[model samples]
Target: MEISLEKPIQQEVSVTNTGDLSEIQRVLTELLYVPDDKLKLVVVLELLDYFKEKFSQKDYKINFFYTKQNGNITGFVVSQIDKEYRSYGMKCPTFGWLTSKDFLSCKLLMGECEDFVRKHKFRKIRGPINFPKISGGIGYQTEGFEAPMLNGVAFNEPSSKVLEYLQELGYKKDAKYSCVEVVESNWNKGNNLDDDIVLKFLHPHEIRELRSQILTLAQNSFYSVLADAPGGQSRFEEMMDSYDLVFGNRFVIKDNFDPRSISSIPEFIEAWESCDLNKIVPCCPLAYDRTNGELVGIIMALPNLFQLWSKEPLTHLNVDTVIINKEYAGRGIFSSLQNVGQITSRLHGFEYVEGTTIYANNDRAISTIFPHSTPLRTHYVVQKRILRK
Candidate 1:
């Protein structure tokens, strides 16, 4: 799996989906190669572990496609059809984890993906969507290369050349994602929510206990907002698995394991142990209807753990997701949530908050959610219609 740094020649490449861990690991490690970046190395390891786990599952159809030029692995991509994944139709494979040494390698790897899609009789192929959305976030970094890499999102070298290669190979943009950063002081202080809607920030210890309630709020809010769009109902339904993964596993650690002990990564351990739960407040504020105590709005953000690996003081936050029930949309809950989040973050020494992964065309979120925030980075998930249905 040794990758050559020398110039790649235009040669015929062979593709295979061996699902071999050691080979897959070497390919990913070399592809994601960044000098002296242990954090990125750890990320690669985590992604490998995720693949190892998913590959063992009987319910998933996971393929690891790699290209070989004169028997040397030049590039690789992952394609999968999981019951829970539905960016494309269930029968279509979502392709991701793409890397290539050059244009020819990219074409070979993606050609294998198209072959897989057509053999299975799927109408269209969609992605660059690396699943769980949090890990190696969906798509290639087609824009905002100047933006600093943040925790909980994808980061690839600017010289990777995968995006342009895909475009040249005739893949169209399936979806576009953008992130925005707002200085604490610049955040607008909108009118407070009505007296009937109560806003509260959860204590770190209580997050596990209220996890179910929070998940319910997220589900109800997302469904109401998304169910009206084309294929939105199914997409929302499919996204519940991601919601469960976040709230049930990633956000709230199990009661049995020490939270710090759960992660083998030293930086993550340091980040977790450094938190003085009482003093360092997380800005996960929830708005509830006072009349019936129904959760109506939520704004979630967490400390940027990657800052530790960068040898910087933890002064940044990643605003992951914000959801408000349609029933509660116009009452300033969204603005109030952001305002509260800004104050909480500022009080706890966070200087900046980046609202990330917002859909590019979501005008409501772009215009209203973080109005004062400036653009940070952008990503694009690509697709090609393999069959003329």
Candidate 2:
């Protein structure tokens, strides 16, 4: 590796393998706020261990870059090529590295990453895809200071100079999604809710009965939001599987929702039960209108306890999905269902709820959730072609 700043200095820039795990940890610790004692760091180490076990004997390449002047280290970047998906079923060729606050070194690091991918014969790239969304993405570009950086999404508080420099280097806006925080203090306490819409906390037995109904709602509403990405159905299935299907303790199902009517519920439940629930904590779901003796809508909440390294625990809640029947849309039933879910979150000690929506969602979620909240984070999905044959 050659190191050169504008106006060209004679200092040698060298690229090396991340031979010292401690050094890597140190660099990342300086960049991110994750505690050394947290399970998140252990999870990251476990992921690296998995990569080593799977790819160490293969043709995979992992390297790091360091800039030194007069034998003093000032900056570094880590890069690795994985032959298999680490997690979340993503199989793209990926690179992860760190760069100093130096502008030229950052540019050089990104160029080296692109070159490495092209040399390895990859056609496209998708990342800074971190192990979990909570660990910020590698390729994040920050624009303004008006908003705080979102936990879990890709982010960096680069100076305005760095932003202009990165744009001149060829990265562009990829995908934009908002992360909103709904504090417990913001709950709609004064608005009178409908008496007929009853909220029930589901147990394992009721979960078994309503499991099929929940899956029906997930699959029906699937294509409406996730139709564009690669293997969207598989990704959705994997997410559902993470909750152990219907085993999440924090799940809400509408009353008397018929599971038999939907075809995918049985299989989902069967798959969910086969996993070890001990590794995953059960989330509470708020099932609405069960007392009305009819099934209408189901809202499920998955507590993201494991990703606490990204944000404070109980400060954020990832709304797994809110499924409402098409016939129940115009009657304000969805609002009622959401109210129950939010209130349940407050009772359980959660401060905010977050979820994703595609370009086609027609502002249904935004109109309902954003008016009373602050934006926490934003994510962009960018793609680029490798100029190789």
Give the best candidate by lDDT.
1
Q: Write the per-residue lDDT of candidate 1 for residues 1-389, one digit (tens) a residue.
A: 99889896756788877777888777776666442366767667767777887888877677888888876778888877655454422344778768788898898888878877877777677777665444456567756777656655556667788888888998888778888877444233344447677766555445445556665665565533331111223233333333332232232233353534433433223333444433324466667787998878877675665565567776777777677887887777888777665654554567878887787667788877556777878888777888533
Candidate 2 per-residue lDDT, tens place, 242-352, comes to 445324443333445343443233322322243332222334434355456555666655555444434554445665456666655655555544554454445445565
Cα RMSD (Å) between model 1 and the true structure? Answer: 9.4
Candidate 2: deviation at residue 68, Å? Answer: 5.4
TM-score of 1: 0.77
Looking at model 1, report the run of 10 residues with the lowest lDDT sum: 226-235
Candidate 1's error at 373, in angstroms? 1.1
Per-model TM-score versus the true fold: 0.77, 0.56
C-alpha lDDT score of every prediction, in listed order: 0.65, 0.48
List the candidate 2 regions with Cα displacement exceeding 4 Å.
1-9, 17-23, 30-98, 137-151, 158-163, 183-315, 318-337, 354-368, 379-381
